[model samples]
Target chain A: AQSVTQLDSQVPVFEEAPVELRCNYSSSVSVYLFWYVQYPNQGLQLLLKYLSGSTLVESINGFEAEFNKSQTSFHLRKPSVHISDTAEYFCAVTLYNQGGKLIFGQGTELSVKP
Target chain B: DVKVTQSSRYLVKRTGEKVFLECVQDMDHENMFWYRQDPGLGLRLIYFSYDVKMKEKGDIPEGYSVSREKKERFSLILESASTNQTSMYLCASSLTGTLNTEAFFGQGTRLTVV
Candidate 1:
């Protein structure tokens, strides 16, 4: 079985400040990792994903996450955040053979204050 | 762009009532998933369908059932609604055979059990 753990329940940062959300996973087999962002009253949107290429993956919105196999971590980072970036982020993992069932973390609420 | 649509944005139902939530994706993806999102728990998978008439249980599948009679439609059914089952329901779809492919989600349906 695979599970994901998001270390931070909430992270508050001022506008233009950098932010990082920690995520760790436990999987016995090789897995695929993903980051998703959910705004208020909306569903989740894909942020980035790490499949089999370089360890680091980036999203178009200036967000990046690196897949560290040794540490079993895929932490998300943004150089700067805006008030509009305030949302909930979730990290998910699925086994390489699993069809499409993703195990998600507890989520980290990012509040970007103006 | 892929589009996933949920039946409702907000729903109010009494305890013990039968509830059904519908989802439709226009991308013709072979995989569809149902998940429930809570405040702190993030998104927990309830069930998923790989193809029409083929359903599989996910992490949390108690008290919930799903039906996929058509290729583009998936429905989540609550045999008997309970207070604990009240949460934001999300539907997502993705192409088959690609573990790294992104899943597109609907706007979500928020259900409140009274």
Candidate 2:
């Protein structure tokens, strides 16, 4: 069975500080990776995804994740986070032909203090 | 953008009461999911429907049931609400075939079982 693991349960960082949310997955076959974010008083949204082709995937809000096949990791990173970036991040994976069922990690809460 | 809407943002129910959480997606997505979000558990899927009248059990579906009479709507039912079932319930929708398609989520419903 496939599973996801997020390294940090909570990360407190100052504004403009760089942040990294580590994620690791266990799967024998190829899979799609995703990062979803839930801001305060808001719904969850897709931050980025890794399907194929490139090893790196980026979201519009300056967040990027690199797919490391050998390490089975897809960690999300932001060079300079803002106060508005405080949110809960979830790492998820779906099998290639599994019809879009996602297996999620334990989540990481990122708190950016101003 | 896809819009996934849940029936309630907050609900309080007594123990042994029957509870229902409703979800609707405007994008006519083929897949709709119900997930329960806890502090350290991220989001655990309770049930998912791929098409009308088709439902599948997810990771934590033991205490829940689902209904999908139409393509855009999915409902999660708790036969008997309990204190342990109090959590944030989230609904999500997505397309089926495309491997890179992302799931869009609704603002969660915070259910409190008293």
**Could you list the chain B TM-scores for each candidate?**
0.97, 0.97
lDDT at B85 for candidate 1?
90
Error of 1 at A79 (Å): 1.3
lDDT tens readout by residue for model 2, B1-114: 779999999999999999989999999789999989999988999998888999989989988999999898999999999999999999998888856578889998999999
lDDT score for residue A112 of model 1? 95
lDDT tens readout by residue for model 1, A1-114 = 889999999999999999999999998999999999999888999889888989989899899999999999999999999999999999998876555578899999999998
TM-score of each: 0.97, 0.97
Q: Is the docking of candidate 2 incorrect, acceptable, medium or high quality?
A: medium
* Candidate 1 chain B, poorest ten consecutive residues by summed lDDT: B94-103
Q: What is the lDDT of residue B11 in candidate 2?
A: 99
Interface RMSD of each: 1.7, 1.6
Candidate 1 per-residue lDDT over residues B1-114, each given as its tens digit = 899999899999999999999999998989999999987898899999999999999879999999999999999999999999989999999887744577899999999999
Clashing pairs in 1: none
DockQ (C-alpha based) per candidate is 0.68, 0.65
Weakest lDDT window of 10 consecutive positions for candidate 2 chain A: A94-103
Q: Tell me how many clashing residue pairs each candidate has.
A: 0, 0
